[model samples]
Each structure stands twice: as structure tokens, then as C-alpha cells.
Target: MKQRLGAALAWLEDRTGLVGIVRTVMQHPVPPGATWWYVFGSATLLAFLVQVVTGVVLGSMYVPAPDDAYRSLEFITNDAPAGRLVRGMHAWTATAMIVLIGIHALQVFLFGSYKYPREVNWMTGVLLLAFTLAMAFTGQILRFDNNGVWSTIVLVKMTSYVPVIGDDLGRFFLAGDVVNASTLSHFFTFHVFVIPGLIFAIIGIHLYLVIRNGISEPPEAGRPVDPATYRAWYHDYLRREGVPFWPDAIWRDALFGVLLVVGLLVLAGVIGPPEVGAPPSPANLDTNPRPDWYFIWLFAALALLPPGIEFYFLILGSGLFFIGLFILPLLANRGERSWKMRPWAVGIVCVIVTGVGALTVYGLQAPWSPDFATQPLSAEVVGATTGPVANGAQLFHEKGCHYCHRIAGSGGQRGPDLTTIGDKLSENELIWRIANGGVNMPSFAGTLTQHELREIVAFLQSRRSAPAPAQNVPTVR
Candidate 1:
């Protein structure tokens, strides 16, 4: 045992020291003309650093309980000074990381960087992508809003499409039938710990490969060199390609990184974190409970398909997608490197992203229903007079009916306003009109009693024709 330990110590001494290690790996050359493209991996890694730091800050303030989750988020967004800024940066920069990593992968693949000598890099990259997506999914669920629960329900149903283990997979996803605090707990663990750990491992391996292979296709590299025989570390290595990490590439990446950071800060400051919805309500019944804009397209697509298809569309479609992603790379010829040579492959990717973008945009602006605007206050016609109109007035504003419609310069402009409505009709005619709305308004007669209907008409009349009440107008000095 002592002899073996001594031998191992001797091997370690040979390669472990600072100078010896440096002198060792410089054996391989960097890509001859290293450009912005070469630094993609570095940028990706830097973005990861940002994510980890930002995530830690977020976890510190966020609560995990049912009652506290929404209120805590409200505090972070509305009360905390820079909380919104931090949240936006965390969210939007995650988007930037995905985009940067994807482009970096494309650049690597396009330049033949994935050749035999650098296959390790390819493997590590694929794993990193999987980790990145996993982190995204888990982080999204951590929001714990109406959309979050709905997204989880929809995704679990989709997961149930797994062939032999379908039911088991669904149960595992739900951790039971419902997404309670436990579901958030599951997501928090995977997002904050497990997935991040796996990603770090993959990223470390990827960096090792880059250093091991010397940035793949340095312009000077012609014939492949033996990996075991690579040499020339500290002395010639730094002397040749040792660009100081700070000023050399740091300026470019740091500039963009700062831009990303500042942009997120501005957005967060301006918009704040997304408004916390009414606490996780099972009956909120937001028909189009779409995820954030990033995943809106997927949700819209899922919604667009025939409801009859059930989960089959999700399963078969996703299965076919991964099948293509993994197997399609093999079709490339040995020497194919240029993007032009892979027209079909590139086209397919473009189409997928474009379709997703288009669908997301469409869903955001799509009309949910005809009766969607702020519903006018309902009142009853009683004693030949509209009932207490202000009661209906209070309900109108209380229900947020103004979001999609206008009323006496008070609401949104999407639907008609009631500024001059009383000029056109008498009380009885107005009642008839209210009962049968034109295009967007819903009939209140069914939903409101005669007294309630009268109150709403009085409210509308008060807005359109009545003199300005002394209480409403402030006197000027």
C-alpha cells in the first residue's frame, strides 16, 4: 500500500505543480484567428455566473409558503427599492443566456469545432443545453402564480404521454395530484441546487475540453496532434496566446454584459416585477393562463390543436422533435463545415424559432372573448328611474371592466365609451339598449335585477348628461 501510494504521489508531483501544469497543456495551439466567435463559450459561462448570483439574491427574499408567496412578491415588486430591477435582470438575462449559448453552439458546429479531437466539447455542450432548459422550466414554476399552476397542470398532462411509464411520470411531476407548496418545493430544489450542480459539472468538463484541445481549429492547426503528447505550458503558452483576461476580451463581453444588466435594471425600475396575481386560486379560471412571453408560443400552440387530440399531440410532437435534434447531426458529411452546405438543417431551426415567435405575439394580442372589456355597472330600472347608479359605478371600476372599454374618458379606448350615451336615448330606450348590447357589451338584464339595472343606467346617465357634481370637481384658487 505504501509503495502504491508513493507511486501515486510521484505522478501527482509530475503534473500538479503550477509551473509544471502550465508547461504541460500549452502543447496544443489555439484557433489561428481567434475572433468574437471564439469567445462565445466564455460569454456563456459569464452569463451563468450572473444567473447563479442573481438567483441567490432572489431566493433570499422570496417566500415558499402559499399565503406569503404572492404577498412577498408584491412587496419585492412594489415596496422594495430595487427589487423589481433585480427580478427583471434575473428573468431577462436568463433569456440572453439561452440565446447566447444557442448561437455559440451554432458557431462551434458551423466551424467544424466538433471534429474528433473536440468531441468532448460537443458532448458537454449538449448536456449544458439540457441543464439550461431544465433550469428554465424549474425557475418558471417557482413564480407560483395562476399561470404557474396552470402551466404545471398542462405540462404534467403532456408528460403523461410518456409511453410505458406515463402515469408514473405524471404522479412524479405532480408529487401527487395537485401543485401545492410541495410542487414549489420540488422546483426550488431542482432549480436552485440539483440542476445547477449538474450544469456546473457539464460546464467544467466543457472548459477542460477547450483548454485540452486548444480552442479546436486555430488557424495554424493542420494535421491533428496527439492529445497525450501536448506540451509547452507556462513559459511558451502564456507568451504566445496569454491575453490578459481583463482588457483583452473583457471589454467586449463586459460592455454587453453591462448593457444587459443596465437594461434589466431599467426595465425592472420602470415596470417592476410582474404583478403578483390573486393568490393561487384553483377557480380563477383564466382560460388563457399562458406562461410568460418566452413560453407563450408553446402554450398557444398547445391550445390551438384540436382538444380531441388530448395529450397525444404533446407527446408525439415532442418525441419527434428530440428525435430530430439528436439524430439529424449525423447526416452531415465528414467535411461539411459551412452553414450554406446545411440549408435544410438551418432552415428547419429558423422555422421553428420563427413559428414560436409569431405564435407568441399573436396570442398576446388575440381577442379572448367578445365580452372581455370592463363590464358596465349593472343596475335595475325601478320606480321609472335607474336604481342607485353609483352602486353600479362602484362595481364597474371594482371589477376592472375599464381595461378593455372606455366610459366618459375613464377607461381604455378599445371599446366604445359612454361619454355622450345619454344624449341619444331616453331612460326606457336606454334600458332596452343595455339589455341588448351591440358587439362587445353583454346584456346586464339577465345578470342584474331590475333595481340593479336601474342603478347602472342612472350611473351611465350621471356620466353622460348630469351636471358636474360639486364633490367631483376641485375648486381652483
Candidate 2:
């Protein structure tokens, strides 16, 4: 049986030159001292493969129609065999792929690999990043949940801000004026077919470029990339110091890729996929729909933008981002490759990472978005049996104070927590702040009756309980 199997394999290899193809790829020359930093590119590719397989499995079970999409996902999560696991893997791996790709891009940028012959490779990478985000957006819509619907609406609004043919593009994205049955089908087609096809094609081109131009060598001090001489210099360097890519250089990539897959599987089994929220319904005003974590920075930025300039920022900001990316390689095709020597490169990266990270944290806390979940203070907290104080407590929620101010952990963080507001402010000061809105806060002088204002003030004045001592909460940075 073994002899027969071997003979069959030999016959196929002879016909197709499979062994020779494998040998050619395996024996490609890699620069000396290539290290684990080089593993991220391969790891990203592995993650993309994982996404393709798991996504196909998910597609088999998903229904694209608006009415059935949510139900179908629920069935897949709760009833189908290995369905939850596959879905979780897909979700987790998408996140991993994004993170890995960012790291890969950052590595290339820091190493100055985008210079000279690799300019096209860098541009293709930028497209891949955009496609990954597009996939994330369309995949969210596949859930057909409240967040998904809200996101679709917001996306259409965003598209409408595009210059020139914005209206047509927005309509095309929605498959109509608004999200309906066609919207779900449209997203499904793009998520499962169109976007993935483009990603695969781009990946093919990216890999070809990488192979043709060869892997960038580790940056050396004073070694500036000169477009005129870089290719010849690289080829000569490779001849003098290169090693076979197969076992000598590829080991780290293989190890990292395996570990990443294992991590995804473990995470999927332990945590499962994110829960499906309320079904798609515009009437569900109580829902505070938010995008996935990767986009929280954008959400935070939009929330923080001054009202009048929002549409302009939404349009111009995005346009400038892509324009900057496109023009970068063109502007500086040759430069000193080391980060230590490129102060501007280091500064730009630091600013971007810091800005995005800060925004994501702000979004998570959600100081700008209204917290509709704030409930009235309990009788225990108010310490009022009846009459004015109790009425004041009731009036607080009725007056929408709890939406912006937390009293003893019962309200939103959009404004300062009113848990100990009475401790810091006298009754008159409290009344003044309430009657005259400060900054983002709304004034109640006209909106509230005199008696209602007095009652609310009385309620807030009674909130004098001391806060608990702070615990040691870990800080990110």
C-alpha cells in the first residue's frame, strides 16, 4: 500500500513539476541575520488563510435576508455543530489579522522597506489594510443586529460626505436610500465574495512583489537607500551573505504562525463569539450602537468633534489620510532606513499611535455618548423617607440628570460623577451650575419649572455620601 501510494505521488510530481516548484520557493535566498521581527508578514498571511476557511464555513450557515439573518446566526451559535467555534475563530482571527498586518506595516516602515523598488508593494499593503477594514464593516452587518443597522446608516452618511459623486456612491452602498432587504444582500455579497476576492488578488500581487524585490535586509547605520543603486547593492549583498529561506530563515515564521493559530483556537473555545444584540430596528432608540474595537477611535473622534465642523472633518479627514498614504512613497523613495536616524518617521509613528490609543480609551469610557441606562438613586442613597428629598430623587431621572451625571454609580460618565457633587459644592453653586449650562451640559433654567429646579437641587444637595477609597486599577501607559 505504501509503495503504491509513493508511486502515485511520484507520477503526479513528474507530470506537474510540483517538487521543483516547492524547491524553488524553499531555496530562495534570505538575508543573513533575519530574525523574529520578520515573522509578522507570514503570520498575517496565516491569519488571512484562517479567515478564508472559517468565513466559508460561516457562509454555509448564514442567511443574507434581513428577516432571517439574525435568526440564522442564532441558530448557528446555539444549534449547529461546531458552529460557535468556527464563528468565534473567524471573529478572533480577524482581529489578530488586523493587529498583525499593522505590525507588519509598521516594521516595513521603520526598516525603510517601502523605498525604491518596493514602492508598489507598500501601496498594495495600504489597499489590503483598507480592504480588511471594509471586511470588518460588512461582516458586522451580517449580524443584522441593532448595532449593525446603525453602523450601516452611519457608513452611508459617511459615504455621502465624499466629494463629487457622493450621492450616487451612498445610494449604491445602501442598495437604495436606506438599509432594507437589499442592504443585507449587498453587504453579504461584498463580505463573502467581492472584498475577499480583491484581498486575495492583492495578496498575490504583494507576494509577487516581495519575491521579485527580495526581503529587505535589517537596517544598518549610515546605509541610505539610493533608488539608483539600491537594487544592485541588495543583490550583491544577498550573494555575499544570504542563506536558504526554507529552514534557516522560515523557522521563526512557521513557529509564530503555528502559535497564532493555536491561540485563536484556544480563544474561540474559551470565549466564543461576541453576542448578537437586539435585532435590526431603527425604532430601538435605547440602544447605544457602537462599532467593533478596531474602529472605536473613529467613533470617539466623531463624538468629540465640534458640531458645526463634523461633516467637513468626516469628509476631509478621511480624504487627507489616504492622500497622505499615497503620496508618502512618492515623496521620499530613498532615505536613511534606520529609525534612529529618521527622527521624523519615529515622531509621526509615535503621534499616530498615541492619538489612536487615547481615542480608543475615551470611546470605551464613552464620556460623550449618552448613557440611557442610568437609573434613579435608591432610597438608601438618597436617605429620604418621602416628600422633597424623595421627590427630588425621582425628579433627577425624570429631568435627565442621570443621563450625564452619575450619583453613586447610577448614572452616565458624560459629565462629572455627581456621586459626591454635594460634597464639593454649596447649594447656591449647585443651583447656578444647573440653571446655567457649562460647556457640553444643557441649561435647565428655561426647560424646568421653578419648583422642579428647587426639588432637583434639594435632591442633589442630599447626595453627600463620601466615596470609597480608590483601588489600584492598572493603567495602560
Candidate 3:
């Protein structure tokens, strides 16, 4: 049996040369001292493979039609066999791909691996990163929930800030003047077909460049990359100390890839997929749509950026950032490779990580958006059980005042805390403010009747930290 199997294998190899190609790839020499840090690139590739497989499974099940998409998601989440697990795996692997690719790029940048012949490699990597983010944005919109729909609308509106083609871009994304069934179909095609095809092509180029340029050696503090003689020096150095990639370096990558897959599986089994929000409804004022965690930083930035410059910051700022990434190798292709010798590189990475981390935390908190889910103020917190003050407290909640204003520490912080409004404003002033709202506050004049408005004023008048002073303070407005 062994002789027959060997004969068959030899026959196939002679005909196709597949065995020779595999042997050549497996026996490629890698630089010495290429350690676990080098595993991220392979791990990222593994994550992308996972994404592709799981995405195919989901695409087979998901309905792209606007009317049926949400219902289909519900069925998959609740009824389909192993559907929830597959969905969770897809979501988690997408996150893993982004994170691993980011870390891999940072590693390459710090190591100065983009220098000399590898400049194109770094450019391809940057394109992959951008494509990965595009996939994430499109996937979020494909959820077809209210939050997803509004998030896409918000993105389209932001796209409208681009200089000459802003409006055109927005219309293209929406597939018309407004979002409809076509918008969903367009996003589905981009996420599943268009963006993935670009990513696959770029990944092919990236891998080829990796093979062409060879893996960079661990950086030494005194060693600086010089394009003139670097390739010859690299080849000579590899001849002296390089190891075969298969049994030597590939083991670490394989181990790490296996561990990453196991970790993703565990997370998917334990946590499941993100909860689907309500059906799409543009008229729903109570909805506070937010993007997935990966994009929360950008959401926070757009919200926190000073009002007038948002257009510039959103357009020119992002454009410049990406432009900088693409031009980095051109600007400093030959330099000290070690972080120990490049303090500015370290500082840049630190600033970016810190800024994004801080913004993400703030976005999760989201103090700017009203808390529509806040429960009504309890009777104990209201400090009244009956009469005008109590009735006013009930009316306060009924009018949705508690959603924006904090009272006794239990409401939203979007507006000022009204826990002690009585000490600051008189009854007439309180009445006037409630009737005619200010900037962030909507005018309740048309919404509240005279009696209900007075009740709300009474409730506000009862909110005081201490007794009023003997001297009467003048009211403004």
C-alpha cells in the first residue's frame, strides 16, 4: 500500500510540479531572531480567512431586502441551527482581524521594515487597513436595525461634507436622494463582494512582496537602513544565519493562529452576538444610535470637535492622516530601525493609542446624547407623596424632562442638574424657562398646558439644597 501511494504521489508531482512549489515555499529562509512578534501578520491573515468563511455562511442566510432583512436577522439569531454561533464568530473575527492588522502594522513601522525594497509592502498594508475599516462600516449598516440604519444616515450626512463630490458621494451611498431598499442592497454588495475583492487582491500583493523582500531581522540600535546596499547585505546575512521557515519560524505562527482561533471560539460561545435593535424608524426620536466599539472613537471625535471646523476636521483631517501614512516610507525610508533609536516613532504611537483610547471611553459614556431609557423618578427621590410638588414630579417625568436633566442624581447629564433649581431661580423664572426653552432644550410652550406647566414649575421650585437667603435674588430672563 505504501509503495502504491508513493507511486501515485510521484506521478502527480511529475505532472503538476505542485510539490516543488510547496517545497520551495516551505523551505524559504527567514532572517535570524524573528521571534513571536512576527506572528501578528500571519495571525491577521488567519483572522481574515475566518471572516471570509463565516461571512459566506451569513450571506447565504441573510436577506438583503430592506423589508425582510430585519426579520431574517431575527430568525437567524433565534431559530436557525448554530446561526447565533456563526454570527458571533463572524463579528469577533472581524474585530480580531482589525486589531491584529493594526498591531502588525505598528510592529512593521517601529521595526522600519517599510524601508528600502519594502515600501510597496507598507502601502499595500495601509490599503488593507482602510479596506478592513470599510468592511466594518458596511457590516454595521447591514444589520438593518434602527441603530444601524441611522448610523448609515449619519455617515452619509458626514460624507456630504467632502468638498466637490460631497453631495454626489452621499447620493451614491444612499443609492438615491434618500435611503431605501437600494441602499441596503448596495451596502450588501460592497461588504460581501466589492470591498472583499479589493482586500483579497491587496493581500495577494502583500504576500508576494513579503516573499520578495524577506522578513526583516530584529532591529539593532546602531544599525540604520540604507537602501543602497541593504538588499545585498540582507541576502548575505540570511546566507550566514537564516533558518528554514517551515519547522523553525512557522511553528510560532501556527501556534499563535491556533490559539487565536480558540480564543475567538470561546468568546463567541460565551458572549454570543450583539443584540439587534428595533426596526428602522426615522421618526423615532427616542433612539440614540451609536456605532460599534471600533468606531466609537470617531463618533466621539465628531461630537466633540468644535462646531464650525467639523467639516474640515472630518474631511481634511482624515485625508491628511491617511496621506501621512502612505507617504511615511517616502519621507523616511532609510533610518534607524530600532524604537530605542527612534523616540519620535514611540511618541507618535503613544499619542495615537492614548487619544483613541480616551475617545472610545468617552463615546461609550456619551454624555451628549439624551438617556431615553432612564426610568421615571421614584417617589422617594421626588421627596413628595402628594399635592402640587408630587403631582409636579409625576408631570416632570411625563413630559420627558428627566431624560435630559438630572434630579437627585438619577437622570441624564446632557442638560444641567436641576436638583437645586429652586435655590437659583424663582417660580416665575422657572415657569418662563420651562415654557420657552433655551438652546439645547426644546420649547415646551406648545407641548404643555398651563396647568401642567405650572405643575412642572412647582416641581422645579421644590428642588432646593437649603432654605433661600433672606435677601431676594433677582431673576434673569
- Which of the numbered candidates is closest to the native, going by highest TM-score? 3
lDDT of each: 0.62, 0.81, 0.83
Candidate 3 global lDDT = 0.83
Candidate 1 lDDT by residue in tens digits, 130-182: 67877777777777766666567667767867788987887787676556667
lDDT of model 1, residue 279: 41
TM-score of 1: 0.64
TM-score of 3: 0.78
Candidate 1: lDDT of 311? Answer: 66
C-alpha lDDT of residue 53 in model 1: 86
Task: Tell me model 1's lDDT, rounded to 2 decimals.
Answer: 0.62
The better-scoring model by lDDT among 1 and 2 is 2
By summed lDDT, the worst window of 10 consecutive residues in model 3 runs over 468-477
**Greater-lDDT candidate between 1 and 3:** 3
Candidate 2 residue-wise lDDT, 1-477, digit = tens? 999998987898899988777787889998999878899988989999999999988999899997798889999999999999999999999899889999998898888888888899999998998898899889988897766766776676677777888879978988976567888899999999999999999999999898889998999879999988998998998899999998899989988988999999999999999898776432343555667888888867877887547757977888888777866798898879988999999998899999999999998887365678777677888777687768878988877777778887778776678876667777777776676443335445546777777777777766666532335211112
Which residue ranges in model 1 land beyond 4 Å of their true spot?
A: 1-29, 218-255, 282-288, 327-333, 369-477
